[model samples]
Target: MADKEIAQDDQRVAVVTGGSSGIGEATARALAGDGWYVIVAARRVDRLEKIAAEIGGGAVRLDVTDDDSVAEFAARIDRVDLLVNNAGGAKGLDPVKEADLEDWQWMYETNVLGTLRVTLALRDKLVASEGLIVNMASVAALNPYAGGAGYNAAKFGLRAMTRVQRIEEATEGTNIRVTEIDPGRVKTDFSLVRFKGDRDKADAVYEGHLNLGPEDIAEAVRWVASLPAHVNIDRIHIMPRDQV
Candidate 1:
């Protein structure tokens, strides 16, 4: 909502997709800590419920790839001051020469299409509330990876999607603004997921230096949302101190 219209509990009623773990979990907790009533959604209902309990928010099971599920979840959200379109990942980090088609499809569906699904589902509420969307993009969206062909493609598509959506919002005269948070090398279950739960392999992602913690990003999200309505943070690129 506008700066003058933002109520005390306005930020509380938000939907955080991919809220089961990592950055999503931390963002939910951070918002709850700020006294915003949050709704955590993800495929892992059990985990989502746990996060809700910890943060005193609500929970919903959502597979961003499924339109029906996303629509139902959107319907369940009564008031959304913010939508953290954070459900995404990197899959099949292989060179194009040996890449499997399934990997490309999964990445596109989850990373790119998933963001689109949730955004469309919540578009009305956002326009009504003049809310903002924080998309969890990665530095990968701006950098090409040797073995990250599929992942990069999906992220690049997602980046384009965010830009286009912003333009559409302007043309549609919607008050809603969009921000993309691109973090470089984060330490979370992300690496584990990328490595198919291989602890040793995942551990190597942050072996040399300290990586961005989930809460660090959670705080960044909070700051962006807390800004005055007139000052929209177009995008934020966050990297760990050691990364540079």
Candidate 2:
């Protein structure tokens, strides 16, 4: 169904960033199946529309890295019961000595600043509903390797931000829930983007490895969001059986 044709869902609403593909797309589908009114937001309007239609949800063009775009996207939603901060990715895999400042900047902007913008904009709605916030962090936040300095820094910052949000919400007794999901070695477009479209490089990352799929992470998001209001899941690290 088209966005206009889809009737309002009586259940709670969820806004998913980076919903055009990968973990974000899977989360949108999962949440909608679980009876959420999902608003799939992404920079790719075409992909968003397709996903929204596929799941009977709404689609909105969103560029989280841009403040104005985020503001406009938030303005379109009257209320949000859940916010999935999934609009982030790794850029290049060059070591620090050979790293490009541009790549690091892009990662920080999308992963760190983008989360901040959307969180601030939709905070009131989340507070109103005593809703949940899920941050799509990564194992990089916990362990840093060579050629992953920039991605590590960005995810580490996100972890810190998530912790602060949890503390603030608790101290204020808002009853809102905050969760940080650190996924390890999930096979998606993540490696593709990180390798700057090098198919071989991307494929090599998952070759002979038992990696988690996008659906796996989506399941985690759905479960966390489905918990009772009194329950709060502070953080969870999801790793494939063979990831360690």
Best TM-score among the predictions, by candidate number: 2
Instruction: Write down the TM-score of every candidate.
Output: 0.93, 0.96
Clashing pairs in 2: none
lDDT of 2 by residue, 85-131 (tens): 99999998888999899999999999999999999999998999888
Write one digit per residue (lDDT tens) for candidate 1, span 7-69.
Answer: 244454778989999999999988888778888889998999888888778888899988888
**Residue clash pairs of candidate 1:** 12-36, 12-37
Lowest summed lDDT over 10 consecutive residues: which window, candidate 2? 1-10
Q: Rate the local accuracy (lDDT) of all candidates.
A: 0.84, 0.92
* Candidate 2 local distance difference test against the native: 0.92
- On the 0 to 100 scale, the lDDT of residue 136 in model 1 is 88
Displacement of the residue 63 alpha carbon in candidate 2, Å: 0.4
Sequence-dependent TM-score of model 1:
0.93
